[model samples]
Target: MKKNDWFLAAGIVIAAAVILLLQIFGSVQNGLTVTVSVDGSLYGTYSLSEDRQVEINDTNRIVIENGSVVMEWADCPDQLCVNHRSISRDGESIICLPNRVVVSIEGTDGKNEENSLDGIAG
Candidate 1:
């Protein structure tokens, strides 16, 4: 075998071992934290839990309540934005795209984020 081939094989083996170790010990997952800023102003930070809703006003005032969160009210005309639903998982979010009102669930940065958001993966 070429000298470079030996190094490549060793690198591959090391990578596999590390992956196996992570699986055995559980992969390190970054904690989830959410901070809401509405209309470029500081809204609030919310912790993850089931059946929780956070309501915000145009003035950036926020209210947190337990239960499925829905669009209680909005200043926008047509009231189309308040018809949206609630989110319960890490990746789930409700956004009034037209109103620029965004509610996002924070999770592991990249891989499996959507699944986490959807509450599919425990």
Candidate 2:
């Protein structure tokens, strides 16, 4: 291989490493709130800093603790939402399709609010 080729390869590897590191570190901010929606309606927003339990219209149950939120129970048959892992990142979510319940994290940058009502619009 030529000297220029080796330099080009090294530059590409460095660029890729920088991109990967940014991605890993950029999304580390803790979520500020948990927004719950049911049946295309805004149900409630709870702060992750406080530990609490939320009942979503008697259809889904949510638990927030230690800066994370999880679906503790759901009346839906599939129970996919209930099985989802707790999320504390800005864009993470646990959605129950059968019951139309969605639990998601909201970040300070405020991107989620713009798309939060998408389900209702369509």
Q: Highest TM-score among the candidates is held by which one?
A: 2
* Candidate 2 lDDT score relative to the true structure: 0.79
Clashing pairs in 1: 91-117, 92-117
Q: Can you write out model 1's per-residue Cα lDDT over 1-122, one digit (the tens) per residue?
A: 79999999999998778655544333222444344656656566665444345566652222334522345666766666566665443444565655666665565455545444233322
Top lDDT model: 2
Those runs of model 2 whose alpha carbons end farther than 4 Å from true positions after fitting are 1-31, 108-122
Candidate 1 ranges beyond 4 A from true positions: 1-35, 39-42, 50-68, 108-122
lDDT of 2 at 98: 98
The C-alpha TM-scores of every prediction are: 0.43, 0.67
